[model samples]
Target chain A: MAKKRGRADIRERFGFAVKARREELGLTQEDLAAAARIHRTYLSDVERGTRNLSLVNVERLAAALDLSLAALFGRVDAGADGA
Target chain B: MAKKRGRADIRERFGFAVKARREELGLTQEDLAAAARIHRTYLSDVERGTRNLSLVNVERLAAALDLSLAALFGRVDAGADGA
Candidate 1:
């Protein structure tokens, strides 16, 4: 059978990356949200992998965390499985 | 002033990368969208950077393009500017 439309793995993995990075910097979700110019609830959802993120939002989070887009994605890659 | 919420740069850069890679494989937008199991119109928007990408969708595109998430994102990183 084909996989489901909405991807849970991506959410969990991406959210994990965000949460890990946030914790590393000792920044709260609210703080990161403010820095990224997004809502705190959205950030919370993102960290839980319950939200789908636009590339722009990813960029915002990356900027707020002082990471390059590459670096943010690097973390996601680390947890992924593919050829 | 803070930057805009919607990032055209991510869209354009990401879309450019997807388009370039798709072309490198000689796949049309329809072909790619079919392979990715996403709609052709959605793929077009993605290629134009007019659509936001969830991690799942990004994964789908990467799968269809025979790229790892890292590789796909590597292209996005290439065109981005951050501290």
Candidate 2:
């Protein structure tokens, strides 16, 4: 059996991606939430590495941002924060 | 600020999506990891809702499974376990 990685790590990585994209597009967390149909606070959590998003939410964000899922996860270099 | 959703929730939802896709395609977590160039343990964690994936790894898994990210996050009904 394979050992599992913790959810926190994944969430943090995802948050970083979202924050970068949000900045690259010149949107605040609030703006992203409005465009993505998600709550601004939730977007903030996602950006701060404190929250994980649902598939539905992910789709909403991606659609709102006009990005592919692959693009959402793109450019994982440390210090690549755009927002 | 909108309330941030917990990372556990996001990881769980993403895992559910991955498990459903893995089963739909008749592939094991190990198989998925291999195809995606990820670790079996990490894939297992992802499947079990225990792990959050890096964007790089998510892309690898998506490509390995031949699924779009939208498809990966599809159909979010409870009791829909495929794996």
Candidate 3:
């Protein structure tokens, strides 16, 4: 049976990806949030891997970073985050 | 300027995608939820486009459906779901 994940590590990896990309673009969290048109706190939480976001929200964040959804999550393996 | 979305359309699209894949596998909502280790209602909600799930949940769903996150969302366009 496929294992259900606890989610901490995967969320952290996602957050790290977002943060790394943001830094590469020289955008602050607020700037990214503003560009993404989301609340700064929400972006912050996402960056901290503390928030579980929807695809739409993830899409928004990827756009704010000027990246594609695939590119944004290019590092993930299918089962790495899921059970 | 990019538009910030209200989320209804995007969520609907995502739900449609999930449902299509699930049906392709011939799994019922209860079966899918059980395989995903989530509640049947939650699966129903997601399939109905009524839920705004977190990344972890999305990951779980994709895993249950035997899909990669990218493969699961292969039809999306950037900025279509974001501002």
Leading candidate by lDDT? 1
lDDT per residue for candidate 2 within A33-62, as digits (tens), equals: 998888888888877777655555665676
Task: Quote the positional error of residue A23 for candidate 3 in Å.
Answer: 1.9
Model 1 pairs whose backbones collide: B11-B49
- Chain A TM-score relative to the true structure, per candidate: 0.84, 0.74, 0.79
Q: How large is the i-RMS for each model, in angstroms?
A: 3.3, 8.1, 2.4
Two-chain DockQ for each candidate model? 0.52, 0.10, 0.46
The digit string of per-residue lDDT tens for model 3 on A8-31 reads 455776787888899999999999
- Lowest summed lDDT window (length 10), candidate 2 chain A: A1-10
B39, model 2: CA deviation in Å? 1.1
Candidate 1 residue runs with Cα over 4 Å from true position: A1-8, A81-83, B1-8, B81-83
| lDDT, candidate 1, B1-83, per-residue tens | 24443334777888988999999999999999999999999999888778878777887898899986778878877755531
Q: Compute the lDDT of residue B45 as modeled in candidate 3.
A: 88
Docking class of 2: incorrect
Q: lDDT scores for all predictions?
A: 0.81, 0.63, 0.75
Report the CAPRI category for model 1: medium
Clashing pairs in 3: A3-A83, A52-B54, A53-B54, A53-B55, B3-B83, B4-B83
lDDT of 1 by residue, A42-76 (tens): 99999888987877788788889887767887787
lDDT of 3 by residue, B1-83 (tens): 34444533667667778888899999999999998889999888887878888778877788889977677767443324543
